[model samples]
Target chain A: MIPVCFILIILHAYVNKIAIYDSFVSGAKEGIITVFKIFPTLLGLMLSVAILRESGALNFISKIFLPLAKIIGYPCEAIPLTFMRLVSSSASTSLILDIFKNHGPDSFIGRFVSIMMSCTETIFYTISVYFMSVKITKIRYTLAGALISNFFGIISSLIITKIFFHY
Target chain B: MLSYLWVSMILFGILFSAFSGNLSGITSAVINSSRESVEICLTMLGVLSVWAGMMKIAENSGLIKSLTKKIMPFLKFLFPKLDKESQSIKYIATNIIANMLGLNWAATPAGLKAMQELQKINIDKKIASREMCMFMILNMSSLQIISINIIAFRSQYKSQNPSETIGPGLIATSISTLSAIIFTKVFEKIYFKDGDQK
Candidate 1:
C-alpha cells in the first residue's frame, strides 16, 4: 500500500514538472521541527504513564471500572488492557499478548481484547501529540468527544464479540 | 485542559506510590520513561521525515489541490471556518486518506502538518479552534477499513480464522467514528452558538 502511494506520488510529481527533491527536503525539515516541538509533551505523557503503571495507580483505576465490566459481561482480566488502550497502544498490545498467553487467543477474553484493541486508539497520546504540535493548550471538547466515542467503541466491541464469538 | 491532566497524572502517581511505599518503583519508571520517550521520538523522526517528504512532493505536483478540490464541499462543511484553498485542507485530506487506508505511520506526519496549518489560522494561538477540535476528534476515532496489526497478532496466536475479527472491528470502528463526528458537530453548535449570538 505504501509503495503504491509513493510511486503514484512520484509519478504525479514528475508529470506535473514539480520540484520534488527540494519540496521533500523542506517538508523533511518541517517534520524534524515538529518532532522537536512535541518532544516535551510526549516526554511528560510517557513519564506520567510510566509512573501510573509502576505505582499501581492504573490498576487501581481499572478496578474501579470492574463493576461496569462485570455488568457488561467482560472479563475482569481484560479491564487493564481497555484502560491502557486509551493511554498507549504498545502497552495495551503487550497486555493483550499476556491475555492471549493465559487464555488462548480463541477464548472469549482474547477475542474481546482483540476486537477492542482494533476498534479504538491511544486517545490521550494522539490528542497530546497533535495538539502540542499546534501549540494548542486548550483542547475544548475534543477530549470529551474522543472519550465518548471510545466508550461507544468499547460497548460495541463487547456486544459484537458476544454476538459473533459466542461459544 | 492538557495541563490539568498532566498535573493530575503526575501528582496522583506520586501520591499513590508514596502511600503504597513504591517510591523506588516510581523513580525507576520516571528514569526509564524518559529514555523510552526519546526512542519513540527517534522512531517518529524517521517515519515523519519520509512521509512528510512524500506529501510535499504530492503537494508540489498539485495532486493535493486536485484531491482537496474533489472533497471541497465535504471539507468546507466540516471546516467552515477554514479557507477553501488553504494548504491546511490539503494536509487534512491527506491525513484522512492515510488514516482510512490504515496507514497509521503515514498519517501522523500529515496529521501534524494539518495541525500546524490549522494553528497558522488560529485567532488565539493557545486555544484550539472548533475545527481543530473536530479534526482531533476525527483523528482519534479514525474508522479503519482494515486493522492490519490485529490480524497479524491473531495469526501469531494461532487463531483458527485470523481474519474473523475484521467484520466486527469494522463495525465497531464505524460506530465510533460516526459518534465522534456527531459529538464534534453537537459541541460546535452548543459552544460556537454563544459566540455567534454575541
Candidate 2:
C-alpha cells in the first residue's frame, strides 16, 4: 500500500505535462461522445434491469433456487448469489448489503451469499456486451462456464462455512 | 507494467478534471471534448498494478501450481487439444483460480498471457483459435468459490466479519463452474463432431 501511494504521488508530481492534460480533456470529451453512442443500449439495459426487479422477475427467479438450497442443506438466500450472476456486481453488492442489513451479517445466508457474489462475474452482461461489441450473434457456451463456477462457489461456500465458522 | 502505468496516468487526469470543470456537464460531451487525451492510462495502471501484484503473490504461494496439478486431468479431458506441458494451459488454470477467488487482479495478466500463447498456435489472425475461444468462454462465465472482492466490500461496509460468505460462495460458484464445463464439452462435441464429419 505504501509503495502504491508513493508511486502514484511521484508519478503525479513528475509527469505533470500540461499538454497531456489538454489532450486528456480533449479525449475525455470524445469518450463522452462515444458513451452517448452507447447510451440507448445502456438505457435499455437499465430499464430491463428496472423491469426485472420491479416486476418480481428477481423474486420469481430466487424461488427457483430454493429447492436446490434445501436439498443441499444450504440457506435459500443463496439464490441471490445465483440470481445476480446474470446482472451487474454493483447491483448484486447492493442486494448483498441489503441481505446483511436485514439478516445480520453473521447469519449463514448473509455471509455465504455475500461471499458468493464477490467470487463470481456478471456472466450474462459480459457475454452480451462483448458479443455485441464484436458483432457476434452466437449465444453459445459463455453462460455455461460461468454457471459451472457459480455451482462450485455456492456448494463450496456451504461446505466451507459449515466446517469452519457457521456450523 | 507499461499498460498499468497508462491506466494510472489516465485515472489521475480524470480525478484532477473534477476540480477544473463543472461536475454537471454532459458526460458524453466531455468524452468527445477531450480529444486524444490519455487520462484512462493512469487509472488502468493503478488497477493493473494492484491486481498483478496480487497475482504474483498467489503464484509464489504454490497454491496455483498445486491446484493446476490437481485439476489437470479433468481440464485435460475438457480441453483435449491442449498439450499437458502447454504454458497456456498453466495460465488458463491460473486464470480460473483467479476468477474463482474473485481476484481479477491475478486473472487478467494470466488471461492476457493465455491469449498471447493461444495466438501463437492459432492459424488466422482475424478469428480466435478454438482454444482462445474456449478460454474466453470459460473466463466469461467463471465460477467463484471465494469471492474475495465481495468479502472486501463487505468488510469495508463494516460487516463485523467480512469474509463470512465463503460457504455459499463455494456452492453457487461450483454450480456455475460445473455447468460451464459441461456445456463447453457439449459445444465442443457438436462443433468438433461436425468438423470431423466434414
Candidate 3:
C-alpha cells in the first residue's frame, strides 16, 4: 500500500517538473520538528496510561463496567480492551493478544474482540497528540463528541459481530 | 481539560498503588514507559518524515489538490464555516483519505498539519474551534475500510479465516463514522450558537 502510493506520488512529481528531492527534504525537516513538538505530549500520555495500568486502577475501572457491559451485551472479557481502547492503543492490543491466547482465535470472544479493536481508535492518545501539536489547552467539547461517537462504535461493533458471526 | 485528566490519572494511580501494595509496579512502569515513549517517537520520526515527504511531492504535483476538489462537497458539508480556499481543507481532505486507505502513518502528519492550519484561523488560540472538534471526532470514529493489522494478527493466531472479520469491521466502522458525523452536527447545533440565530 505505502510503496504504491509513494511510486505514484514520485511519478506525478516527476511529470509535473517539481523538485521532488528538495520538496521531500524540506517536508522531512518539518516532520522532524513536528516530532519534537509532540514528544512531550506523548511522554506525558504514556506515563499516566502506564501508571494507571500498572497500579491496577485500569482493571478496577474495567471491573466497575463489567455489569453494565453484561447488560448491554458487551462481552465481559472485552471490558479491559474496551476500557483501554480509549487511552492506549498498544495496551489494548496486548489485551487483545491475551484474549486470543486464552480463548483461541476461532472462539466467539476472539472474533468479537478482533472486530471491536479494528473499529475503535485510541481516542485519548490521538486527541492529546493532535491538540498538543497546536498548543490548544482548552479542548472544549472535543472529548464529549469523541466519547459519544466511541459509544456508538462499540455498540455497533457488538451488533455487527453478532449479526455476522452469530456467536 | 487535559491538565485535569493528567493530574487525576497520576494521583489516582499513586493512591491506588499505595493501597493495593503495588507501589513498586508504578515505579517500574513510570521508568519503563517514559523510555518506551521515546522509543515509539523515534520509530514515528522515520515514518512521519517519509510520509510528510511523500505528501509534499503529492501536494506540489497537484495530486492532493485534485483529490480535494473531488471531496470538496463532503468537506464543505462537514466544515461549513471554513473557507473553500483555506489550506486546512486540503490537509483535512488528505487526512481523511489517508485514514480511509488504512495509511495510519500518513494520516497523523496530515491530521497534525490540518490542526495547525485550523489553529491559524481560530479566534481564540486556547480553545478548540468547532471544526477542530468535528475533525477529531471523525478521526476517532475509525473510518478505515480494511484493518490489515487485525487480519495479520488473526492469521498469526491461526483463525480458520483470518479475513472473516473484514465484512463486520467495515460495517461497524461505517456505522460509527456515520454516527460520529450526525452527533458532531447535533452537538454543533446545541453547543455553538447558530449563525442565523445571532
| Candidate achieving the largest DockQ | 3
In candidate 1 chain B, where is summed lDDT lowest over 10 consecutive residues? B189-198
Model 2, range B1-198, lDDT digits (tens) per residue? 212322443344344345445233324423432321233334434555555544444344444566799889877876778888787888789887666655564465566656667666755544545565567667765555555566666776677867545555555555555666666777677766655411
Give the per-residue lDDT of model 1 (tens digit) for B1-198: 888898898889999999999999999999999999999999989887888788888888988888878878878888887787787888899888888888887788888878888888788898888878888898888566788887888889888888888888889988998999899998888888756511
DockQ, every prediction: 0.75, 0.12, 0.81
Tell me the fnat of candidate 1.
Answer: 0.81
Residue pairs with clashing backbones, model 1: none
Stretches of candidate 3 exceeding 4 Å from the true structure: B196-198
Candidates ranked by DockQ, best first? 3, 1, 2
Question: Each model's TM-score, in the order given?
Answer: 0.94, 0.54, 0.97
Off by over 4 Å in 1: B194-198
lDDT, candidate 3, A58-97, per-residue tens: 8898889888888878889888788899999899889988
In angstroms, give how far residue B143 of model 3 lies from its true place: 1.6
True contacts kept of each: 0.81, 0.24, 0.80
Determine which window of 10 residues in candidate 3 chain B has minimal summed lDDT: B189-198
Residue A149 miss distance in model 3 (angstroms): 0.9
Instruction: Name the Cα RMSD for model 3.
Output: 1.5
